[model samples]
Target: MKLYRHALSGHSHRAHLFLSLIGQPFELVDVDLAARAHKQPEFLKLNPFGQVPVLVDGDTVITDSNAILVYLSKKHGKTDWLPETPREAANVQRWLSVAAGDIAFGPAAARLVTVFAAPIDAEAAIARAHVVLKRMDDTLADSAWIAGSQPTIADVALYSYTARAPEGFVDLQDYAHVRAWLARIEALPGFVEFQRTPVGLTA
Candidate 1:
């Protein structure tokens, strides 16, 4: 398997973390976002959306970080991680949606603004982040993981950017549950530290 990813992308980091956790053997092919390599014709053939973290398993090419997580967890993870029941599956999907939707637009976007020095509406991003964070805090108030007691792909999907949200200027100080959750995820076996790049890269 080959993973086309940018070193600075949180989305890419999720896949890298999952692969490492599962002890999956794969090749890492760096995608030079600095050179706009992902937007070029060759890279687009791998993913029309022109994004990093594209996974190529032999002839099957998968795009989207969450989609790749689902594929990988179903294929390589223990049944506990993916689950078999519909309600359990829905719980997983719910958090995955939060990770990909709210978290992506909120904390992730806010971080990008600061990291890239992009012209972002700071007030708007903060408001967006607060809404999501409040929801997360409330959701985690009575649960250990996003999808019940055990960690699942949903937790993996949100771990990277959400954990480093402070770097994006969305402080986690107010979200105690989130902070605890972050620590729990980090303590999992095979957990790997996220790679950090020199600041000022556009995502």
Candidate 2:
């Protein structure tokens, strides 16, 4: 398997982290975002969207971080990461949606401004980050994991951005539960650390 990714991208980290957690042997192919490598013809052929974190497994090529998670979990028969039961599956999907939506626009967007100099509303992104962080903290108060008692792709989906929310100037100090959850994930076997870039408030 080959993962085309950029180090600073949380989306890329999620896919990379999961592949490691599952004990999968894969090669990392770094896409030079600064050089616009992902937007070039060769990379665009893999994903017309011209995004980082495209996973290639033999003849199958998967795009989107959450889609990559689903493909890997189902292909590897890691039902523990992706439950088959209707209710459990729905629960996991719910969090995946949050990861793509709120999390994307929130902490992830804020970080984009600082890390990549993206033209986004940093203040609004930070505000949105707090809203989603509070929701995560509240949800985690009653459940060990975002989807349920065990860690799932949902956890992986939310991990990278949330763990580094501080880089976006979205403080994690108030969200005790979320902080604890991050610690729990770090202690898990095969866990890989997301590369951190000091920026925003941390700068």
Candidate 3:
């Protein structure tokens, strides 16, 4: 297996984290996003979207971070990282949707502006981050994991961006439950952390 990923990308981290947690053996092929390598023709063949975190396992090539997570969790992870029951699977899917939607436009987008200097609405992203974070915190007030009692792909999917939300100037001071959840994830065995970049308020 080969994972083409950029160090700074939370999307990339999502796949990498899961693979590590599952104790999967694979090679990391760093994509030079600084040189716009992902946009090049060769890299585009793996992922036409020109994104990092493309996975190549034998004849199977998977694109999209969330899709890759689902693939690894279902295939290699058996029913561990993912669940077998219909209701549990649906619960994980709900968080996956939030990870793609609110988490993408919110904390992830805000961090892109601060860390990469991408031109985007920082205020809007920060506001969205707060809304999502509060909801996550409230949901977690009763639940141990986002999906259920056990950590699933849904927890892995949402962990990266939400943990680093503070780097985007989205202060997480009030989100105590969310902070605790992040700590619980870090404490898990086989956990691999996303690379931290000091930016925004942290600077």
| TM-score of each model, paired residue for residue | 0.93, 0.99, 0.98
Give per-model CA RMSD.
2.6, 0.6, 0.8
Winning candidate number (TM-score): 2
For model 2, how does the per-residue alpha-carbon lDDT over 1-203 read when each residue is reduced to its tens digit?
Answer: 99999999999999999999999999999999999999999999999999989999999999999999999999999999999999999999999999999999999999999998999999999999999999999999998899998999999999999998989999999999999999999999999999989887787
Q: Summarize candidate 3's per-residue lDDT along 1-203 as a digit string, tens digits.
A: 99999989999999999999888999999999989999999999999999979999999999999999999977875586789899988989999999999999999999999899989999999999999999999999999899998899999999999988888999999989999999999999899999988887777
Candidate 1, poorest ten consecutive residues by summed lDDT: 194-203
Model 3 per-residue lDDT at 33: 91
Minimum summed lDDT over a 10-residue window in model 2 is located at 194-203
Those runs of model 1 whose alpha carbons end farther than 4 Å from true positions after fitting are 197-203
Model number with the top lDDT: 2
User: Better model by TM-score, 1 or 3?
Assistant: 3
- By TM-score, how accurate is candidate 1? 0.93
